[model samples]
Target: MVRNSRILIVDDVVDNIRVAMNILKEENYEFSFAQNGGEALRLIFEVGESFDLILLDIMMPGLNGFEVCKKLKENPTTQEIPIIFLTAKVDVDSITQGFSMGAVDYITKPFHAAELLSRVATHLELYHSRELLLKHNINLKAKAKHEKNRLLSELEDSQKEMIFILAELMEATSDETGKHIKRVAETSALLAKYHPCLNDEDVDLLYHASPMHDIGKMTIPLEILHKPERYSEDEFSLMKKHTINAYSLLSHSDRKLIKAAAIIAHEHHEKWNGTGYPRGLKGPDIHIYGRIVALADVFDALTHKRHYKEAWKIEDAVAYVLDHRETQFDPELVDIFQEHLDEFITIAISQ
Candidate 1:
């Protein structure tokens, strides 16, 4: 009793078509009629609407029922439309040919009304059920993809938070204030943005990793780390070891952000002219991450008051960085620093 279902009744005899429609009239289904196989094929092809079940005659002039069924089955567009053969032929070979031609079942002529109604209802119900299942499967897959993305987003946030907490803990061991770490992170990201070779992802990684550049200072003795005056020759030598110490502490991590932090920690103090300690890596030999952070670290340190020195004027800090362009820092990085000095000063003032 599916009122929405559309059924096609095809027969060369007009009386037979009327008989079939009358039998199905109680169900209130929309009906269509074709007098011959050729007309049936044309109706199915030209009609914008689809037929739910096709009741087709086996023998007719111009393209018999078997021929129409075969052609419909061969086409992808109409292949899944169920076809039932209705004919006078009751011979074994006739039924076999009907089945072979993709008919769902053969209903011999003089068929019982109950039998016709039952088979039509059965196939229509099956078709609707199959459609529902396919839609359910599509919805399930979409939900699964959404959940996967949500979990990944949460994991990334947790990783970034852990990195920041660890960097703060390392800073707690020395005279550096937490604000210094924040300013260095901002400055490093700003510099990376202006560098032609770095992409947006690289800039983000530097922003998070620059805070740990002096994590090695945790390894220095508390007395030397907190001293209010310049370090003695021996004291300075021991203090320089913090860079290597920071590297050793973080180098074994497999995470990309942690690896970047380790590189920054190890080489941020290395000079461009090879005069720096702890490997003395110079110029292009120094990792770009290290070179960028080196300039960021010095600029922030110079402008901020610390246990060992009072804060210098912003102008003096700017001049000092410009003077050391190719000796203490990468020339290219120094140029970027000068170009974006206003933005850098804003970051320092903000923190």
Candidate 2:
């Protein structure tokens, strides 16, 4: 007990409260008295935050101290207030019940003055210290969450910047604008949403990785890349190396986006029927990312003019894709592409 500290005494018997108050009145502590559990609860609800500690009597009329303690412990605001049970029984069961109901300590009736002061002082000190530690832990968790969100934002920006720069690098070989890469990425991501194999992470990785599908073209000679006529066999062989070159450029990194990009670059040229170049992988042998980028790249390339070819009509390009289903492209992917024709057209127009 200390000066200015509020203590509540709840007992049906007036003499018992008088005895406890007299024992600690010399210390200048403030006191409040209640005749039963109901009165104690009313006072607590009215001004529980003003109370530093409570000296409660277990045996009472109407509501018992155990019931009052349970109510206090269940409340968010009053739960932290230290409770000391004043019991006459001194039995193990009563004491266990008091502590179990969230009492900090229990004192037997006919209390000694020195013992009362010591227990009160110790519990008050422990309670306030625990409150300080709780506040610190809550603040620490808030700051940690804020820092985690900031790092994720930075990583997202880094991925976008890297995708943009690499896409431009690949398009520079043929002297075309980088919008082709952007359109391919958007189309690939849109088509991927229909895939059973891809989750959210897979969709995001494909969107970022698809832009690098033609990164191998950056290694090809400007003459071959921009030739007016069809490529000679030797020139075409050099040109076909772009896919392998793309894989080589991206395969060194273990990052999810880069690893997916490597696979796309490596197998995008492989045909569904084993006729296309590089590895000549067919059907399910090609990774899904590869198959997706292959469709995206060819679709965008056909609808737009290139150094070697004129742009085909949208209908003609789409018909060509349908004609080669399961031969030049994955069959299901072609179906999805046809199903979402309007969306692809809108993307082609917008991007």
| Model 2 lDDT per residue over 1-351, tens place | 245678899999999999999998877778999999999988878754368889999999889999999998999888889999998889899989998999999988789888888998888778777877999999999999999999987887797689779789768767567889889888999889888778888778788888888888889888888899988899999999999998888899877778888898899888899898799898999888888888888988999988778899999889988998999999999999999899988887786
Which candidate gets the maximum lDDT versus the true structure? 1
How many clashes in each candidate?
0, 0
TM for candidate 1 is 0.73
lDDT of 1 at 146: 97
205 Cα displacement, candidate 2 (Å): 2.8
The alpha-carbon deviation from the true structure for residue 235 of candidate 1, after best TM-score superposition, in angstroms, is 5.3
lDDT of 2: 0.87
Q: Estimate each model's TM-score.
A: 0.73, 0.72
Local distance difference test, per candidate? 0.88, 0.87
Listed per candidate, the RMSD to the true structure in angstroms reads 4.5, 5.5
lDDT of 1 by residue, 288-331 (tens): 99999999989989999888888999999999999999999999
